[model samples]
Target: YFQSHPAIQPATVVVEDRAHPSTSELSPTWNRTDEWYNYRSNPRERVHVLAALDESSYTGGTMNGDHPIAWCQDYQGGRAFYTGLGHTKESYADPAFRGHLLGGIRYATGHTQADCRPENGYRPLFDGTAESLADWKQAGPGSFTRSDDGTLTSSGGMGMLWYPGQDLGSYSLKLDWKMASASGDDNSGVFVGFPPSDDPWSAVDNGYEIQIDATDVPEKTTGSVYGFRSADLKKRDRALNPPGEWNTYEIR
Candidate 1:
């Protein structure tokens, strides 16, 4: 139930995000035999989808033609990856299948990097580079310092970095980030739906936030849509990389 977008039906998935390390080792349209489970929604444009079901290859598929079967995302300060494969016990014994699993683990653990940028008409909101932040406007007190490696580490007070170039309507925004704190107790979040304002409190009153403090309750912790909703803790835990590791988040 925690899976944001589950599988459509037990069938094979066609690799779409071919550049990702996990799917890069496989053929573009490899097929597998597994029990696919349907998800509540299609996570397309919301994640870097590695594989999708070739609807033509399956009969009961229902995500139009752009069905994602496996994907990776940056959750609140941690990596989040999901794949709807390996239902049957025999899947574990298959060498090709095992390799796929290993590649995913490598990408998730930050042992390797992948081009997880979300496509589907989404543009960079914050790409961890100074050029990307040319129009970024900070509000509140503390600050995030940009490093030579294109990472923004928190250094100052409590504030927010927002895009000031244009007004965002309905679009998927993706970013890669990492919390340097070892205990994962950092205070960070992504706010949406609020207009540009000098006072950060305006955001607090008008916008919704996806919090990054990983040590709180399900409703108030990392991956939570603030106090209104809680991420599925079990699924979140499985997908999260620890502090000091890079993670990605795609907010739609």
Candidate 2:
């Protein structure tokens, strides 16, 4: 019935994302006694994670080392929020806890707003539209299908979508994507660090690719900087949403 199980104990809460209204008024290190619960999975990139539990501060930490205690997500029709606090009857009596609850409520109900956007630095390159693709140059075979809801899906891509307009050195790139395949296996990658070339193979030779296919070996799978560095599978697997669901990737 629950993905996270609870434990009645004390914890030192640490603010992970401080820009949010919920964590703005609270102290950076909050020491409180509450029934902390560890989720079977983490909803990191899937939500605006306001705060997290310092695993070293307590036990029953089943979420490996990374645990998200407070997070909020913008749903299809409304917003949803979850916190690993407020288990005991005396929790509501605490003024700091009450303030935290009020702040969360205000942001959820649109009574106040915060910059809930993910990936702090980086301008949008392609906004999931065919129109946005004008800024990009397609080299080689296959194409990406632009959907009405603003998602670009790979059609038959042995090709490359290259942003010829800019030469990036130190910058962050972020995009939200979902594969159509049910097996959680798809073929695509966001290529980087290469010069503008009409031939996509040049990027393959000189630049780097962040793999999207999950079926490959760890070195070449999703979150891997193809052939160069392997992602920390333990952390990557915990952070990933299932394939058919929209997932946000922040490439720095």
Best by lDDT: 2
Estimate, for each residue in 28-92, the C-alpha lDDT of model 2 and write its tens digit.
57899988886756777677777888889888777787787888877886877667789998899
Candidate of highest TM-score: 1
In candidate 2, stretches whose alpha carbon ends up further than 4 angstroms from where it belongs are 1-121
TM-score of 2: 0.54
Per residue, candidate 1 scores C-alpha lDDT tens digits across 154-220 of 6676677777788878877765555668999977788999978977888889999988889988898
Tell me how far the alpha carbon of residue 17 in candidate 1 is from the true structure, in angstroms, after superposition.
12
lDDT of 2: 0.73
Error of 1 at 19 (Å): 14
Cα error of candidate 1 at position 71, Å: 13
Ten residues in sequence with the least summed lDDT for candidate 1? 1-10
